[model samples]
Target: MTKRQRFLQRTRSRLFSKGAPDYILLALVVILVLFGLVMVYDASVIVASETYGDQFRFLKLQTVWVLVGAAAFAFTYLFDYHNYPKLIVPAIVTTIVLLVLVVFAGPLVFGSRRWFSIGVVNIQPSELAKLTFTVYLACWLAKQKQRSGNLKEAFTQHLKTELLPFAFILFTICFLIIVEPDLGTTAVVAFTALAVYFISGTDALHTLGSFFIIAVMGVLGVLAAIISPYRASRVSTFLETIKSGYAPDPWISGYQINQVLIAIGSGGLFGIGFGESRQKFFYLVGNSAFTDTIFAVYAEEFGFVGDVVLVLAFLMFVSRGLRIARNAHDRLGSLLATGITVWIGLQAFLNIAANIALGPLTGIPLPFFSYGGSSMVVVLAGVGILLNVSKSSEKAVFR
Candidate 1:
């Protein structure tokens, strides 16, 4: 039979197979995207008005991206996710080209050359890099596993073949991002790659050895940052404030964090009311309210109750994502789900914690809620993949 006939046969078998529908996860994704839209509008109004001379500018752009992202989500849902393996090489090549292009062709933003400006909007290649790398690695590793039967075959050659290439890719990407000076994103991608490596079951010893190398690389990364006067100053400022009781100057390194604190603290038990944020009035400034410190803007406008509801929504997403991973039909599917869950969940935790002063200001946005096209698009696409996996699950896909 031709490939098209085989595809039709498989599709019919899958459609008539004994498995639950995947609407539940799809619905949850829609809910999160909608929630993000509401929060983005609330957080970005002032920034947009001040920066772009229109209150609805950021909101309009975000709406467009969300719409495009949702369409991508639906496209993936209708397509077979197992076919991801077929697209891996092209995706990786595309990602690498973008990454390289960003270095030479992209415009600088916030002292980092991370975005590729296309007329009206800016696209961050690093965001797409995460999903692309995850899918490629998972696909490659799974095939390696299938070829390895006994422990000895797996140990002697399979692990080396599978892991070394991943390590090289991770290091190269990490180096480029660090050069871009997007420390937070580089860290996230590096760690996510490590998670995939660990899940691939590439020998405990190899995994542990990789951990050691990564730790050394991390230390060197810190040294590199220290060598840069500006970065060194930030680190010093971060440490100095810890040692001295003197309040941090709002004009310096502490400015962003202070604004974040004021926004959250001013809200108290009840928020300042919708669109009544005092901080947004030449206080928070620029895209701060929309991206890195969105939770602060949210807290200021929605109060404690709103915060709780948002957290609950995230908790629900996490639970459902984990469920999808657990019931995945195969190891590749399981690893893909788990990696995405960790990426979104950990990033969310980091963003929330940074806003509340639980950690240093990492300049990373809350996933789904932040005002960025690449993140919204790629994250939704990931959710689409998760839904595809859910569709293939033995349990009810709709439930």
Candidate 2:
């Protein structure tokens, strides 16, 4: 055979020799993104037309974000996953700096300064923090694993060496996020970090101790909430909704949650049919119909059946993520996979629960389905890291 033909043959063999990164997971992600684009247009068309004089304004912006996210996904997927540890320090530092900048310079939107407006694009540092913290924690835990001996030694050493730093970093991030008045993101980041710590093979005693620390933090968080009238009002509103089973007035405090419930109930078994949702027409209040409360608008359009499909897609994504973690080639890969999975899954659950009134309105958007550029980019980048890990594991097993 000619040299060029032989080279081509070898390239094909190398590419196809090992199993590819989980195609099922990739397919599910693509489906969700496509579905999100359609829903974003359906939910935002009227508002876009009225506010911006362009019916496709939000749709067009969301399409651009999806393209940006796709590029991020491709870059991360093709890059080596094992090299992420080198990025841990930079990631942590960048997040801290941006968060501080947000406090001082971020644009105020709806009474909170959680986003930096660069011309037309708004960047939420908290979203970047979530992904950065996950990467940092994964690297930290993996290093902890390598440095320690057995379970008992690991536990003792972690307590002696790692506990203080870990607590400091975790609380710093959480404090910054909460001060942004974004309690939902704070909780998600805290929980994701704790999950990574637990899965890092720490002893049972250390795990329990970690939970005790988290509980103490939780108590402090509750006290902080009670001290703030704005937060306390949210608590009261939630309680009132639970007690009365609906908001007392459509124009009052619990109006958003009530609207969400109306949308869900109106969806019935098969939905109101595509872009036919009446709630998006200034009934749901605010831009939530396209952002945090997008799920309700979705249900209103596609019904209970669509809700089930979306839930199942998330479940499948989580399952595939865990499977990748299980078969990962290294401790870092495993922890990174687990952290990303929990971050996305937990956020999605909190958003859905808030929509259905199972939890207080948290203002947390659904992953991949919400209308935000920063969140879409960060989340898709995380998924790229996960796919890279899966690819590495496949290569490890086959070669």
Candidate 3:
């Protein structure tokens, strides 16, 4: 067999050593990636043509990223997932430092400095930080799971073992991102951390208390924004648009959300039949066709049916991820698998929700489907790690 075939066979053997992976998850990922490619091309064509004078500009860049991401995924699959826990601290530290560096040394764009230029490609440290935080949290939690007796003991144990370390790391990261002022990414990381805490079997009362505190913090944040002239203006514009019949001006604050809703409405049931989306043709200015608003393009073209299918796909991915967690060979493996799964599912849900106006506009990308270099690469790499975990889970040494 060729090296590639050998690698696949060996990994499959290990993963199925416990039992075969649910094919549904793999199928869903494949389907989403393919659909994303089509929609990305469709949504970004006009923008690409306008900016680069080439209709295929965005498509070509996305294709390159996908190809590179696939290689990353493959490399992760060939390694052992359990080994990652050993490297968690250093990885987290590196990410944390990068987060700090981005604050001082990163380039500022769109009123945020979340990106660090690494040669030709600008890298978002926060994206990698999300995964690093999850891995570190999982390892820390799994270690703590051993010392607890009852719920109270577990709660206290978690507080000392998990929360303290997590707090320092999370605060450092969040502080940097807030300085960059990428509220959306900070929110995503916070949500991902909450998901990990929830799945790690923390006490409900404690978790609820934490949630309440977070909610209060968020409200306070908005209140602080209300006092700042610019942030207050942005908030006021969003509220005004919602309250009034239509936003009178599109050039300012409400433009992106307004245009997204319009694109969704224009698509109807079957979508404007692909590549015919009018909003993408300069109707929407700030929202990138392939990234934050990719779902809008999909909805406009695919309509309700298409939307339903995307939801179903997410459900399948979550189901398989949960299943993998259940069958994980050891505590570390289980935690890693669960953390990764929750991260992906949570992001997917949040992105789709934002697109449909179920929530406020958050600039999060749809996993695998949104046009972004770091997000796509990170997600695929995550999948590879999960696959590796599945491979050795059956024989995992659970201490």
Please give, for residues 1-399, the per-residue lDDT of candidate 1 as tens digits: 999999999876655554644555567667777877887888777767767899888889999999988888887767887788998899988988888889788887766788988888888888888888888877876676454566677665744786567777777777766666666677677777777667767556567647765885687468548544555555555565556632267687777777888899898888989878887666775777887888898899889988888887778778887787777888778778777777777778778876776666657778888888888999888887877777767555434
Candidate 2 structure quality by residue, lDDT tens digits, 353-398: 8888888887888998999999999999999999888886745322
TM-score of 1: 0.87
Which model is ahead, 1 or 2, in terms of TM-score?
Answer: 2
- Model 3 scores a C-alpha lDDT of 0.74
Alpha-carbon shift of residue 76 in model 1 (angstroms): 2.0
| Candidate with best TM-score | 2
lDDT of 3 by residue, 1-399 (tens): 899999999876744455444445666777787778887888888888777798887678778888888898888777776677688889988988888888788886765676777764778888887788888888877776465668877767766776666666666666666666666676777777766766776556457746754774475456436433454554566566667745546766677778888988887777767667777877766437778888888888888787888898888888878777887878877888888898899888888876765555657788988777888888888887777776655533221
Using all chains and alpha carbons, the TM-scores for the candidates as numbered come to 0.87, 0.91, 0.85
Identify the candidate with maximal lDDT: 2
Give lDDT: candidate 2, residue 329: 83
What's the true lDDT of residue 389 in model 2?
88
Q: Give me the overall lDDT of model 2.
A: 0.85
State residue 25's C-alpha deviation in candidate 3, in Å.
Answer: 1.6
